[model samples]
Target: MLQIPSWKRILILAVCLFGIVSAAPNLFYGRVEAHNDAIAAAEKAGFETEAQAAARAAWPDWLPSGLVNLGLDLRGGAHLLAEVQLADVYKARMDALWPELRKALADERATVGAVRRAPSDPGVLRVQIGEPAAMTRALEIAASLATPVVSLTGIGQNDLAISAEGDQIVVTLSEAEKLATDNRTMQQSLEIIRRRVDEVGTREPTIQRQGSDRILIQVPGIGSAEELKALIGTTAQLGFHPVIARGSATGTVPGIGQVIYPSVEEKGLNYTLDAVPVVTGEELTDARPDFDQNGRPAVSFRFNPAGARKFGDYTAANIGQLFAIVLDAEVISAPVIQSHIPGGSGIITGNFTVESSTNLAVLLRAGALPAKMTFLEERTIGPELGQDSIDAGSVAALVGMAAVVFFMIASYGLFGVFATVALGINMALIFGVLSAIGGTLTLPGIAGIVLTIGMAVDANVLVFERIREELRTARGPARAIELGYQKAMSAIVDANITTFITATILFLAGSGPVRGFAVTLTVGIITSVFTAIYVTRLMLVFWFERRRPKTITV
Candidate 1:
């Protein structure tokens, strides 16, 4: 009477086999990882190198190759806590606003008198007018440039605060706009840092916002914190400005609406350039490392349609004048505009090595960080420490597993063997699910598996004890087994459901290693219930039907 339907039995066996096969790749993690990397590299490059081909051949192409990602603690790497300099964005915004404000005021010079920018706070733009009585007109002109803040909370608020102070008009961002800008700056910094890290092809890097202004970056498999810092800290802000004059760095002073920048190649030379760039890197569509006409390393860049139009007009109108290529506020090159360039494509030639050119191309493609970042904390975890943790975790798991298996066997003679087999299958299924989902394994995750090993046999213990009690009442073996399973079902489901809910809460409320533990616990609960209720029951039903035992002990 106690028998599994044919389809149900087949489904259970199929799932067990799938779990085993899917989890097999983790056993050969090193080889499979190399093979996967090789495949990825070949696809990205559109051709296979000899080493890549050899690595690919090492692993069979037909097998499932998904592996559980190791977390920072499990695979030593770089960790950095960086606070974004949000005020830097405020200054840049003010700087960009000065030109537009100057032009607007210039149109009303008869009413507002001669206008010039005055030194003020970092984020404040101050304008001085010759006619003190026309301060009201200056205020009106500044207010005209203010736009409504484009945020939900700041819906009715304007972005700028304009007030007349004596003969000067003070312009600064409104409080609501400052808040909005801070949010945007943090978001942009996080995205740029993530893009830069991903360009290096590292696995499972944690690039997450920690607090309001800080970002926590944990890049597993990276060489060091310094390496990651170098990759992301460059800013790579590129722009093209019209050069006013090039002279020795000794005593040249920039005029109003202009700035002086030192030449990158020529140490003693400086170039005075317009503060407002004709085109910025934000309009770049593509950048690639290439060789110049003389076979020297260079970076080739193409701009978008709007940028192309602006660049073409500027070059055509200023032929024979010097144009400065600026990166991070330094003049990389100052070349004379020989002819009209229409396509918005150009090469940046400087004292660059091939590696620098490639890095520059990567950075330009990723875009620039919105603001500077200051590293608050930095650490480099060693691989040796990670190996020790892995070894310790492995030993704990094996010991816990051995203890559970021994206890199950000692308490319930031959029935314990069925439970042990189910336990092994449950472990495989847990790993199989983790791999399928690309879950990360941390040190805490390993502890969760050890906890799962102990919990895996709990359902079997309940069923076996129930069966023993049924046998005392003179029920037949088949009838007692069926009743035992039926009676134990409620208790097993209640216990696992409560535990699963707890794990879910932990996952939702936690982060990093806490979430890792929750993931393994959650997966273990599902697989353990499946193995205990279905797989073990199916095994027992088969053995009992074949032998036709008249009497049995749980």
Candidate 2:
């Protein structure tokens, strides 16, 4: 009557063994972490060092090596909330559209009369025509400039809204285009931030978009908020522009459609270059820190096929002319084209330290942020505070667990000891599942585990009480035990399923530490149910079979 299917018994034992093995690495956390880091470094370097080899050998590859990643709250790190300046991107888009719009209008100057730029709002591109009567034809030409938005959400909508007011034609981004641009900007910012953080090789950094315009960044093991901010704050816009003029005077100014930028190596030396770049960093396929022929620190870059073809054509036609290499609108180098440079490879040399060269390479490789971001909030959580939290949580868990164990033993004797053992296995399974899924453990997650320890015996308690009641009416001890399990099944399943639903809702709706708590609570519910119903029953059956007890004590 109390029999378990052979296959089911084997499955339960396999799960227990897997959990124990998987959770074992956490006991030697530092060593296992070192082992993982060494492997990653070795793979990146294409060779292994003596230290790396030793680290690898310390943790075998065949074993389950996954470990739970610690969250910012528990690990102590820098946090930042940055808001993207969406209006700045809009202004830039309008500024770039000016040259093209001017050329288009000039092509039909015979019909519309002379067209000139008219001052307007930051993101509004307005042009005035000499003849207001021909505005209808001009409006048609201006409307032609509005292209269909390529985004799914913006399909069938034009990128620009064109309107004519008296003699002035106004152009601004359409509502659909603005929505598309905002989404694209946020996604690009998130990706760039992630790349920058990953370049530094930080462990388990949390970089996510918070709202439409804000990004939330958290980096554990990083020193300060300033440091984290520095890694991501750079726009790192790199471009190649045809040089128009060069000057050393303090009051030098650029002509229309040109920009004057100060030299990076030589202060006060300025180079006037075209506002539009022949090629930008977005076309770069690769960038790395290297040394020039003169042994000067430099960053080498290679461009994609399209960029390479454009660059080759320009260089071929413009030999003996100067072109400016600009970074963040500052002239990094202005070198004359002596020969036709093919293949789209070049070096950026400056008065750079080894560190600066490396950082530049990293920036180029990560690509540029789409827009400027202003940090609205910054916080640094110290390791000492995190350690304090860990200590307090550890103490609370130990005390709670001891109280639960004492209560169980006093109430149910040997059956209570079996429940406690099952609870331990349940805890191991929770950690194993967390490691397997790469879940982050926060302070609230620790609380969830402690709460789970106290609650893990619920199913066992139900079965024990039912068995005691059944002992009076049942024919034999085995039948009583079987009936106990059968009677308790419905209540345990109903209770756990309800709680699991609540935890799922919390996980879906909550953020940060709340989500962390929900994760552990959900995992704990599943593991606790498994251990309470299955593991405890297996142990009890083994004990009863060995002793052949006429009457089992609850």
Cα lDDT of model 2 by residue, 370-460, tens digit: 8889999999999888888888888998998899899999999999999988988998899999998888888999999998887799889
Name the top TM-score candidate.
1
Worst 10 residues of 2 by lDDT: 249-258
C-alpha lDDT of candidate 1 relative to the true structure: 0.93
Position 55, candidate 1: lDDT:
98
In order, the Cα lDDT scores of the candidates are: 0.93, 0.90
What RMSD does each model have against the real structure? 1.5, 2.3
Clashes of each: 0, 0
How far does residue 520 in candidate 2 sit from its true spot (Å)? 0.8
lDDT of 1 by residue, 239-288 (tens): 99999888886777778678999999899899989988999998999999
